[model samples]
Target: MTGNLHAGALLLAAAPIGRPEDASPRLREALSAAPVVAAEDTRRLRRLAGDLGVAVTGRIVSYYDQNEASRATELLAELLAGRDVLVITDAGMPGVSDPGYRLVREAVAHDVRVTVLPGPSAVTTALVVSGLPTDRFCFEGFPPRKAGERSRRFAALADEPRTMVFFEAPHRLAATLEALAEAFGADRPAAVCRELTKTYEEIRRAPLGALAEWAADGVRGEITLVVGGAPEPAGLSDPADLAAAVADRVAAGTPRKEAITAVAKENGVPKRVVYDAVVAAK
Candidate 1:
């Protein structure tokens, strides 16, 4: 907001998600420059500072979800006191799945100027490497952990045309994949991105079913999943049940290119025939 900016500056810095070496030079400079540092995990922050060989002269304070509300007023007070304050989360950008959202919102409401230190983010990184359509996309964040809620959640996004991205825990990855397969259909194209920029980083592109089966053995580390979207609706020339199968895949998460390929391959028909039918249907 204008209050802080007019008075001084409040910086929102992005912390490394996994690899500490990803720390930007500006971030390191900001760490030492800012007088007060509000960190999600002070211990980790201290360790990062040590690794970077930067001595922080700032007064470190904890600002996590549990204490953010009460701490916000104090942090804002620091800004109002004409002290430059820097906020950092444990990983990635703050507010995506981290702290600092409330403080930022309050700062804006109170006319305190807010600035962000742009850096690595799992959401965008996963999307670009996902190999799905990237022209248009939406980050769904993390899906519900429970089976019932998770199933219902995936059911809602069954027809999302843009590439969809989600964060999943390693232990829950298998169940999540299975649920996606059932909700979006087993054959829908998808990719699982794990350990983003870290050394063991891996991106597996395959149908949802194949990933689900692989996850049965259990996958670990930070997981980002990108699922293909609903396919264009078309008709079949099976003379028996072309429209039904096409509609099923379309409702699931099969795009035109994939749907045409899968339907023609399954029904013993020409790909052009299915493509024309879909175009006419639309």
Candidate 2:
């Protein structure tokens, strides 16, 4: 019976990341035009429609990450019946670090045509407003909340040449900037964009060290940090100097694991060899 149904179509609609007034006319029309609206949070979706003065004509259903797996088949069923299934996340584009990835994957598997409605994006908004170099950049999504894991992740990004953008909670902004300073260097240029595109929007551009100090006082609203990457180091290709760095950190009370990470990052060498050498010495 499912095989006999017409091909399904999935609509990925971008939601306002911060403000309701940013809703595009097309988004409002889609809200009223879709036969079914799959929302990350149906109540919030309804509220948004109310604020936009557009009544949703379709049935509203929850389709977030937790339920996406079990609900995909059902939503696909509705779509296959020639219903326009509009997928809206709580904010921003549906699949960008949001709940729509799984459903989109399922839709593709079912031979359903999928397209997006471009609208307000926190990533791009924060990047341009940040006053940092944006000629080459990459969206890092969000960093790990746990400090240890977050440190490790930042360490891995030490060699990234282009500018980087990341989403962070306001509460964690200080610690994240501190880690960026340690991994990238205190003198590296950076920008902290808070409450972007909202009435309280703020952008602070400074060295990572200074920004970390400023964020220590506490900031609110959604936060995005654009950080400069590790600069090309001088004499990084010297093996003996790299080995000496490993030895010095170990002498300074850094653990073998931590020391290896620090030295490999400083020398632009892979950590495996340094780790193997430390293990051999032990």
Candidate 3:
């Protein structure tokens, strides 16, 4: 059924990544007022509510990855019934590498109003605190677990020009860092932020190789990784070098015109210069 004027909205709440006090006032109000609270971890939600000195007055249900699909259907029904269903994850915003996506999508499909209670996020927290270029960046979530998949994924991103953020478990941090070092480069600048916004929080900024070595000694707490983007290739002034660069891209199946444009941009030269070089070589 389509939503009516009295239909309830779906609230996607952001939980504090570490400190309970980071919880927003709107979140506290929603916790106490929502007709149904879908939590990634009910136990952890209870603890957070208690720590916030706010008792949740709604029915609490588990809504983690295992039952996300089925639970989304149920929650959508609740919204359709004029009951606000608040979705919260263990930490950070719901549906961010988390379980709220299905419910949000369902609610939208059913014309149920959906909104967000934005607050703390590990992605931005790490990126801002990493001292890296924040003008342009991307969140990669987590790397693939299998060695082959992870290697291929990193290889694909090796030429990415924007700062990158990632979430990773403490247990796999060492191996992941090593793999990133191998794929990106040993000297790539990176930061490993652990237990952010909590006691004993640590931000270790170093080259990928050194961070890999440090993590091998064993680290703890939640982890967020920030890595610098690939450095711009040195500007090519030599016509031979510029022509060769375009030729290499053309050989790799890139269109000649597109290759010339890319080579011009990469080497801080003009398109005319690269075009002339390509023509001169031909």
Instruction: Please give, for residues 1-282, the per-residue lDDT of candidate 3 as tens digits.
Output: 556657789999999999998998998998999989999999999999999999899999999999999998898888888999999999999998999988888888878888899999999999999999999999999999998999999999988999999999899999999999999999999999999999999999999999999999899999999999989877898999999999999999999999999999778677999999999998
Each model's TM-score, in the order given? 0.80, 0.81, 0.86
| Model 2 C-alpha lDDT per residue in residues 183-232, reported as the tens digit of each score | 87899899888877779888889999999999999988888888876667
* TM-score between model 2 and native: 0.81
lDDT of 1 at 5: 45
Better of 1 and 2 by TM-score: 2
Candidate 2 least-lDDT 10 residues: 1-10
Clashing pairs in 1: 1-111, 1-112, 1-113, 2-111, 3-111, 4-112, 231-254
Task: Give candidate 2's total backbone clashes.
Answer: 0
- What is the C-alpha local distance difference test score of candidate 1? 0.85
Task: Tell me the whole-model lDDT of each prediction, alpha carbons only.
Answer: 0.85, 0.85, 0.93
Ranking by TM-score: 3, 2, 1
Instruction: Write the number of the candidate with greater lDDT, choosing between 1 and 2.
Output: 1
Question: What is the C-alpha local distance difference test score of candidate 2?
Answer: 0.85
